[model samples]
Target: MAARSKVMQLFKALHRTRKEVFKGDDDALEAARQNINAEFRNNLTESSPEKITELLKFGTDVEIILRKTVIQGVHTDHNRISIKPRKEILLDNVPFNHNPTIKDT
Candidate 1:
């Protein structure tokens, strides 16, 4: 009974995190919903207490990672957010020179 309760709690927490993290993105929210449902469904047959505990730990870790990294929100200077760009894009209206030779007199 306790194990079942724990599982339910974890499931609910995951959904909440998804809602908060994927705000303004319906496709992402739906994808997360599907993935979470599929994972829980696939693990329906899991019975061993040890295995359940391990799985729960993994789920918790995943939630923490997603909240800390994937999710973006307003942050302070002390806690800066880092977003990595896939590829460098030049700013609009910026002039680019191919060759530059410095002649010193």
Candidate 2:
């Protein structure tokens, strides 16, 4: 996989979680973000073999901060409801046409 492709994949995965996995709830958003982060981190192992490894690591860390921001966006919620991990579910459903090995950058 190319670095650009990996980045696009990561963004798409995160975007999917933000749109589908999370509702307008605080804990749910946080949980969704966490799941997305975890999925990105896991995929980075194969997506970005060299250069993107560090980039994805940074992305994971930044995602933690972004998750907090998302939580804050829904601070009005009182029930503190959380969404289940949907990363695997989402990934499993997405069709992949290739198993191409990413070359080291």
Candidate 3:
């Protein structure tokens, strides 16, 4: 029972991380959701405690990497989430131009 609960907690954590990391990209979000579900489902038959622990460790590592490095758009600090603007947006000096009308030069 404890092992099952641990797995459930890990699954929830992974889903939350996925939600934060892939906020804007629908394709990446769906892919991550499918992959996470598939991996857990594939391992459902494993009965050994040692293997389950290893799997849980791997999931935690993946979550850490995804949250800390993979998705650079979202910044998380002490449970707070901040959206980071893209490099172009930060580097460009000109204000965003919605419509460019060519004036006679």
Candidate 4:
């Protein structure tokens, strides 16, 4: 009972992440939606508790990866592309080493 709810929750979270990560791109959204559904459907009959637990954890990891690493780009014109970046992929807020200097010993 509880495990079923957890699976559903993970499924919903993945969908939400897909929408945000693939906004303005119809193809990506459709592909990701289909893959998510198919993976879950393929394992619908698994009854082993250990395998189920591993699968759930893997799903959760995938969701996190999508949220933190995904970025979108749009081809606005013949010669230009526009990048749509979420904060998760932005490095402006992080401390970065912009330059390194070599010193003689």
Candidate 5:
């Protein structure tokens, strides 16, 4: 019973993240929706608690990755595009491990 609740929570959270990550794009949104549904449906008969827990963790990680790493770019002009990054992405400013990072330059 507990595992079932967790599964539903993770599933819904992933969908919400998908909406924010793929906003304003019908094709991408539909694809994401289908993918999420398919993944959960694939595991609908899962009866192993350990395996379900592992899958839940993976789903949670995926949601985080989508929210933090996915950026939406909108076409504006022929040479210019606009980006609206989610706050989750901009909040983490991890620079590469180089002697001279962008901040130093």
Candidate 6:
């Protein structure tokens, strides 16, 4: 329960930051780009387009962003989803410990 709440909090923070950053923008491209960049820096390999498109269906349910043209079949489904950049951050906020074992030659 707490984990879900934490996730929601983080998303809310992200949305708030996004609105502030792009008040007049028609899309959330800038915010999405930043999120993706941050995710990449953290070594969170993002899923491919297949996954992104699957995600779009969910986004529609959430009413985040959608295009009427796409809905009307004027554009491809890929164009409908503006995939925001994503990063994989640990929920517990623990520092990663890398310990490699040495082998005798």
| Of 1 and 2, the candidate ranking higher by lDDT | 1
Worst 10 residues of 2 by lDDT: 67-76
Local distance difference test, per candidate? 0.80, 0.58, 0.85, 0.91, 0.90, 0.44
Model 4 lDDT-worst window of ten: 89-98
lDDT of 6 by residue, 25-103 (tens): 5455575657634643443343455554444444343333322111211233855744332232113567676986798
How far out, in Å, is residue 2 in model 5?
0.3
lDDT tens per residue, model 5, 1-105: 888898989989999999989989999999999999999999999898889989999999999889889999998999999998877787766978768746654
lDDT of 4 at 80: 96
For model 3, what is the C-alpha lDDT against the true structure? 0.85
* Candidate 4 lDDT, 81-100, residue by residue in tens: 88888988877666667897
lDDT of 4: 0.91
Q: Supply candidate 2's per-residue lDDT for 14.
A: 64
Cα miss at 17, model 1 (Å)? 0.2
Candidate 1, lDDT over the whole model? 0.80
Give the TM-score ranking, best first. Answer: 4, 5, 3, 1, 2, 6
Clashes of each: 0, 0, 0, 0, 0, 3
Model with the higher lDDT, candidate 3 or 4: 4
lDDT of 2 by residue, 14-100 (tens): 665465535555676687667766766776556436657777667656544444443323333696654444343423466666887
lDDT of 5 at 19: 90
Write down the RMSD of all candidates, one decimal each. Answer: 12.6, 15.3, 13.7, 3.1, 5.3, 17.5
TM-score of each: 0.67, 0.33, 0.68, 0.81, 0.81, 0.28
Worst 10 residues of 3 by lDDT: 83-92
Candidate 6 regions with alpha-carbon error over 4 angstroms: 29-105
